[model samples]
Target: MSRRPQLTGRAAVLAVVVCAIAMSLAYPVREFIAQRRQIAELQQQQAKELDALRKLRDRGRQLQDPDYTMRQARERLFYCEPNQKCFVVMDRGKAPAARKPGRAPKPKAPWYESLWKSVELADHGVSR
Candidate 1:
């Protein structure tokens, strides 16, 4: 006949407590793993942003140099030497082939132009 070891009340209570602890820890372990993955993703994004910041800083430093500054001014601002004449070619709604160098048109008045009257009114002297 095989004899089974009988568990005491204290041992049964201890086993139940251990099982409860294990069950409670499971969710926290899974949540911790998910949070670690998210942290890695955020760190990767931070690295990319830092790299972009460094590249922009390098570009700013290059712009401070005389050659790069002069080149950028000439291209973007249409700047030339003092003796050289600068011609600005503009094309309106007309044909592009027949466009000539001229000044661009001015901006039109807004719809509420009458509301912005600023004429000097004549002041009449008040007699006491």
Candidate 2:
């Protein structure tokens, strides 16, 4: 019975070369993938920032218009033009119900009277 060599010298050399090449390429490949992911994330953030900037630009343009400013003021600050009678109509539909007849809450004594009472109690060393 004859058995052939499972691994030849040339085959071993080829295998070692392939492993060396793979090891050399591994770090660069991993870094490339990570950089691509970071680029995609940055692109998404840039798009969002561009959208916010566009909105702010629109708001800025609106602010430059006198009529827009007046409208905003009237809506936000309840402003009225001179000689224009503007009455505010409060919501009266949600008025609170009157309390049923019961003992009213006792009114608090004046601060001076409370202070004098505290002084007297301290002098007498008595608690009520």
Candidate 3:
């Protein structure tokens, strides 16, 4: 009857080699899974971009109509036909007073004068 080979140094070394090869594959397998996840995320982003593009196309088609163009100009740009009086309503609380342009900035006082002012304030027990 034929006899099986005994487990010696060579067989032990072969078993260790097999185990090492399997361990080495772990990183590659993890990287493959990560790449698959990235592909799925990119596909979802592409779908959202395509939907936005469709909406923009629809807006472009709407703007091609003359009535829509005139309405948009009147509402957004305050455009009016010739000989028509236009009244702009302004909120009293938010309106700014008009100031004349070309005014130069005032010059700063000398450093010694500022230091003396601080000293005077300190002597009078002021917090500033």
Candidate 4:
């Protein structure tokens, strides 16, 4: 009787065949898994785009309504009806705040005075 644990010729051959098949299938199986993940990501992106499209369709519908346009104009453009009067009242109650005194910059000498000083220095140098 053969020992069950000992690898016979047929067992070894079968193990080798199984490993060969697995090796052959490895790249295709990995690619299949990667493609499935990519498909899932694309489906999620499509769902988001569909949701955005639905929102834009709803907005288009809202834009078609005259009341919505009127309301938008009243709020955004400050549009008044022909018979009605609207006034934009300014807050005149608050007076302009006076500025506090800050440090004054030192006054610089006029450009002609500096030029004359340079001329005097050059004349003295020539004289010496």
Candidate 5:
């Protein structure tokens, strides 16, 4: 008959000790992994915020420049130098038939008249 192997007391004790050590270390290892992931996410968020801050700072610096401010005013507000003629081109589809090409040029109003019209429009809460 073949003899069956039996577990020795020392071997059993060693196996139990190894299992206990692994169980003791598991929670701390999981917590360490989670904390590392959180730190990486926070760093990514911080980098994005820093990029946004840099863009805003650059815009602020541009705003501090008189030439940049003038350019913005000219583009956004349609501002022109004194004595310079400014014409606003309306969309062909939106313009009145009378304003089409080959029609008689409209009489020019005084500059103050147009300025006052803009002021009145602004006072009435018009956007532009």
Candidate 6:
């Protein structure tokens, strides 16, 4: 049978050089891919910012119109003309519990009397 070719010194050296080149290029290739991804992300962010800018510009144009400004003021700030009356109708379901009248209602009885009353109520299993 024909003998297999042995790896000569020059051939081994060439193989090592090829492997070295590949290893050296690996990191740069990875860095190039990473940079491309970052650029894509930045482009997407720029597009979103441009859309928001357009919306704000439209809002600015709307605010320049006196009729729109007056409507917004009337709706948002409950404003009315000199001859007009404005009444606010509150939703009872969303209203806070009615507070006792007066900043600090004077205790109807002295502190000790109130404390004793609370103790009696607790003893009878009653809650205010």
Off by over 4 Å in 2: 96-128
Report RMSD (Å) for each prediction in the order shown.
10.2, 5.0, 9.5, 9.4, 12.6, 7.3
Candidate 5 local lDDT, 53-119, one digit each (tens): 9999999999999999998888889999899898767685685556667878889999999999999
TM-score, structure 6 vs. true: 0.62
Better of 1 and 6 by lDDT: 6
Q: Indicate the worst ten consecutive residues by lDDT in candidate 6.
A: 98-107
Clashing pairs in 4: none
Residue 83 lDDT in model 6?
92
lDDT for each residue of candidate 1 in 1-128, tens digit (9 for 90 to 100): 98866997889999999999999999999999999999999999999999999999999999789998888788789889799887766665667555456966678877566333322122333332
List model 4 lDDT by residue over 1-128, tens digit each: 95687878999999999999999999999999999999999999999999999999999999999999999998888899999998865566887766667956678999999888889989888532
* lDDT (0 to 1) per candidate: 0.82, 0.93, 0.92, 0.91, 0.92, 0.93
Winner by lDDT between candidate 4 and candidate 1 = 4
Candidates, ranked, TM-score: 2, 5, 4, 6, 1, 3
Which 10 consecutive positions of candidate 4 have the poorest summed lDDT? 88-97
lDDT of 1 at 9: 89
lDDT of 6 by residue, 2-116 (tens): 8867998899999999999999999999999999999999999999999999999999999999999999899899889899988877775687767787677565788999899
Candidate 2, run of 10 with poorest lDDT: 88-97
Superposed model 5: Cα runs more than 4 Å off:
1-5, 92-128
- Mind giving the per-residue lDDT tens digits that candidate 3 earns over 10-125? 99999999999999999999999999999999999999999999999999999899999999898889999899997766675786867679976688999999999999999999
True-structure lDDT of candidate 6 = 0.93
Residue 67 lDDT (model 4): 100
TM-score of each: 0.51, 0.73, 0.50, 0.64, 0.66, 0.62
Candidate 4 vs candidate 6, lDDT winner:
6
